[model samples]
Target: MEATTTSQPKTISPPISPTFRISGGRRFSNDTSVAYILPSDQDEVKRLKLNHDLWKELMNGLFKSDMHEQLTKGIRVLDVGCGPGWWTLDMAALYPNSQFIGIDMADVFVAQDLPSNVTFEQMNAGTGLEFDDASFDFVFQRFLVMGLSVEQYSSSVTEMKRILKPGGAIEILELINDYSNASPAFARIGSWIHQAMSARGLDSFIADKVSSVLETAGFKNITDVNYDVPIGPWGDESGEMFLSIQKLALPAVKVMVTELTDTTVEEYDKTEEQAYKEALSHQVSTRFRLIYATK
Candidate 1:
């Protein structure tokens, strides 16, 4: 991707830390607007570091080609709900002339040092964005299920389209919750997690419906790119990657189950670990859908 240079350099301030809690028996934390739990905090920095390492391996294994090829130089890019700004930093490095703005509700895990062309903002995806209309060349949102509901997804898509330049592209990436290829134990665990997430207002499996949502938001030339991302604890190089993900997901699962139900965190962890072990016995896969469209 080529980078775009502007007269004004973007600046991002450090974000304050917030308290966190688990409301149900789910793995993801529900962060109140005033106070939030971010996995990238100093206390949980180890998890963040491991997650980033695994994420890099996962992305590399999944997309062998240059993943940022479409983001050309001199373009304006916006990443909504960017966590830790890994992708943002990678894009900035790939295209130095391009300006990247990453917006999230909490900035607990944002990089301490950002490149000159990249900036981050603490903002809610469900509310107002501090940007002008048609201000961005490309808008990227990934793994947003934790932060938005179906309605919010639609609204966010509309807002993204509004900020995108005419004929600009928007990419929405998400994972499917169902484990069609997983063992029965893993499938059951996945189902429970999906239902819990739905109850908490976040749908873990929304990739299939995203295309229609994008279409409803007045996007044209929409295309869906689907891939089966493996998710069992073992297999090959990718299996090792999945193992790391499963480890990282333990806390998020604890947050979800304990917050929503009467289940103890220890019990939930044990159950999830068993399910993950069973899942590894089979060739399990997670669905990754990348919906791309033009304004």
Candidate 2:
């Protein structure tokens, strides 16, 4: 009988970000903070639940083959800008051995009863994290473009690298700003939102730059995955979910735009409404990009 020797796989140290902190500044006023810090709006909470459920389902379908083995084990995960904590909770349940921490500006929407492994914190992503270095096995974030500027995005990625354990992974998911289809009206509205965001120094189209940003932040072995996420009232499988999400998103867009642009609230609202109507008649597309990088 011949004995075969198996070689041990080489392990590489994950990327590490320089120790630095960015000031969040007085971004939110006392009144605005009171409103945002309070319990999340009931309608918005429901929409988040629906959106997470749809996303989980979609991910399962899309990554069917890898879901069971890779995602269902002991993995320490950190979710930055984890709105409502849906994904964090789901991941906690899915990976019982894994611990999940969700950090967001508001903790109002987080579940009152979370699993033992799940934790929530109210922290700004632009600043330094409270956690110790090399703490997590995976760092995950999604749809964070709204709250982050390009500089902040770069800084946050570097922060994620710092807390990630050797050989750990970082995953970032974001959507493109362009959403236009059969109905030109939705396109018009999307354009307005895009312009507003751009004007405020926020890049709604930042998805395209994830890879470069990660690389610049010292991440290696980076993989970029792009998917087309449909928006509006189209009849595609994810269309209903998209429409529901848009309903909530449109209002948020208006508020953010008004705050950033110092524009009249009424004008922003009108623009959002018009864009939503156009979205219903057309099949708009939003680009979703997922950057998976290993330290």
Number of clashes recorded per candidate: 26, 4
The lDDT leader among the candidates is 1
**lDDT value for candidate 2?**
0.65
In candidate 2, what are the lDDT values of residues 1-295, reduced to their tens digit? Answer: 1112212222122122232211221123132222121123444456656666666655653222123354556767888887677777666665778788988765443555567998888687866677889988788888777667767778888899999887778888787877635355566556666667676567877889999988887888888887777775565768778777877766655554555455576766676677667666666766688778788
Give the CA lDDT, 0 to 100, for residue 283 in model 2.
66
Clashing pairs in 2: 14-295, 15-295, 183-282, 186-278
Question: How much is the lDDT of residue 194 in candidate 1?
Answer: 71
Least accurate 10 contiguous residues by lDDT in model 1: 1-10
Please give the RMSD to the true structure for each candidate, in Å.
5.5, 10.8
TM-score of each: 0.80, 0.78
TM-score, candidate number 2 = 0.78
What is the TM-score (0 to 1) of candidate 1?
0.80
